[model samples]
Target: MADEITVTVVDDHPAMLVGIEQWYAAAPEPLRVAASGATSKTAWLPPGDAADVVVFDLQLAGQTTPAFGELRRLVDAGRNVIVYTMRDDEQTALTCLDLGAVTFLTKTEGADHLVSATLAAARDRPYTPPALAGALSANTSSDRPKLSIREEEVLVEWFQSESRDLVAQRLNLSPKTVTTYLDRVRLKYANAGRPARSKAALVARAIQDGLISVDDL
Candidate 1:
């Protein structure tokens, strides 16, 4: 991480907005609050400039998009999101990660820790507080599925290729066969208590399984 890092903060509470701004203001040379907004609808992007990481609150005021949907919106906009909220349970943390959060932090942790976590996330490393770490660790275990050689080939190609048909063409197999292998992969994940129901989720699983690195995405 750089000695100076830029961040954009999204929170719904007025006090929280002030508190976070003050927190970042007091942080050491490592953290800088580049921009901040009090609502999820607040624009994160500033023309010709972008933040290194986005620290966000999951619960926004009013009836708005789902937590993960808002998270996806930030990521899809090309900002790495660090979920900092009161909803620090394992399920919420993992789900945010599933939707592509760079890391998760609880609101109760010290402001210094939040600054550190934000810095770590800016460097593409996840900083899991000990409490949330347990849940993430529990999701991957020895029972994690072992794919057959062909299945591995299909999955690897699927990860590398842009589409299923392209994967099929490259592997010289019918699209149907490719689908079958990918389906089995999903089943195996489900059997292991790891449910990857979407293509994005499967890509996350591939990263967890060492099948691909973050950069490959």
Candidate 2:
């Protein structure tokens, strides 16, 4: 379908591939696993199933080709990517970001986070899982910032609202004000070195931080 966000997963472990397929089996509309394989060469995106994003694992069967090298090529080919791997080191995460990965999510972050990361990537956004987000700031000893009460109210309302204007109206704020607050949230994340960089990414962060649930989307 035109609206379906196609995905290609590259992981050597058979069970992980199965697990992701099962998780997305119930994902909301507009997301589908188009194809998968154990290595980049074997991974294929069929003519009808051109992938929008690739969920790649760092370690593959051969291990000769660095996953980052594959990532750069896929991204250069105009495909978004969410790095799904067991390694969660800040250095590797930073390298992935530098290599143009849309997001870097450790497998331990849970299936929901992986799904959310793909959604964010498809939307041209960056999603940093909570732990990874914090890792970005570890070098500077920076603590994650708290959103103001108004910011929290706006975010929750926006997530639950049918429209931004509706959220603004319900919050007794102007549409511009709502936008400003959301921008602030984005800026805060960026300033902390955990840049969310897009609306959908912020939504993912909201879910990660317990500010909202998947149902809220």
Candidate 3:
């Protein structure tokens, strides 16, 4: 978290673009807005493409609906995406999470949450704001990946612990074993049609499946 986390912001509103840059600049943490744009098309190029994380607005300029396509594209390209939009509905939040967003945040959550989420996303760590936690708790979808008892234990410990090596030490297992268990968990999620490649995504899946809670993180 000590390192300056680079960010790319994509929002249709000119005021929002400027506001986010100001917020990042004024934040106590090292969050630099490397690039910004009114659309995802331009944001996915150059500086934006190389940013540590991307803060995306779900509703863009010319879209009548939430920009799921843009979000999916970024996630598929292995970019860490945080959906910073005005849409606060549980379904929208869950949909973005399922699409592999690092986390979903509403603009009204303020700069603190934005800064925190950006930092966490840059490290592929989990940071659940109030809105995202509410969405996870309200989620009623029963689509959960089946996990072995060991895999489940490792996943929860990994979420609570700082690193996999710490989890291995706590469980008296090797680091490689811890990683194997985590990989299995991820495989199960992918087989269930839900991909959990990043730690934040895994945390969201764990919460939705009742394996862990926001309070645990």
Candidate 4:
């Protein structure tokens, strides 16, 4: 299907993999689990590389704790990853978002949230699941990206506007200048170790820094 959202699922549990595949198969929209594996190598190395979105389980079978290394590798490679795990805490969710995951979802969020998040990730669109929104709201850390006034203006306007052109028109600046400001904003976030590669990720960053609220969207 032309509009089909292709997914690469990576989970350690065989039963969980089966369940996820079933969820994708029965999704309301055109969705496909193009590939799945029990580990990073088996799941994302070959066939999974071409998938539109990667549904990843943070805690794999072998190692203890969440696998931030693998997650970092994927994000650094410019892959849109959704960290699906059983852990449902504000810190963990915030950590994943800061590391550049497209979004974070707990396994308990179920099929509806999972499918919606997958679709949003595949299309490079914004999606904030309830858990993530809660996390963003609960976050009180002082850590933030140090953006210039112009950069913040452009960033906030871009978030409110549908497109960069609209932002430029509203600000009375050239489209190229608007793009430059946004690029600088992303760079500042990246330099602060809070990568914002997607609009959704940037939105998450803005929320974390208290520059915007969930209601602002």
1-217 per-residue lDDT for model 4 (tens digits):
7888888889989898788889888988888888888887754567789888999999988789899889988887778899999898889987887888877888877888799889868865445555665565455678755556676666667645536688789889998777656544443433455544664555565566555567745
Question: Residue 111 deviation, candidate 2, in Å?
Answer: 1.1
- The CA-based lDDT of model 1 is what? 0.63
Model 1 bad stretches (over 4 Å): 1-3, 47-49, 64-66, 138-217
Superior candidate under lDDT, 2 versus 4: 4
Per-model TM values vs. the true structure: 0.59, 0.63, 0.69, 0.69
In terms of lDDT, the poorest run of 10 residues in model 1 is 190-199
Candidate 1, residue 60: lDDT: 76
Off by over 4 Å in 4: 144-193, 199-217
Candidate 3 on 98-190: residue-level lDDT in tens? 788877888878878788788868866556655765565455578855556676677667655536688899899998777666544543433
Compose the digit string of candidate 1's lDDT tens values, residues 71-154: 777766656777888875667766776566766677776677687677656655434444344344344445545667786677
Screening candidate 1 with a backbone cut-off below 3 angstroms (N, C-alpha, C), the clashing residue pairs are none
Task: Report the number of clashing residue pairs per model.
Answer: 0, 0, 0, 0
lDDT of 2 at 29: 56
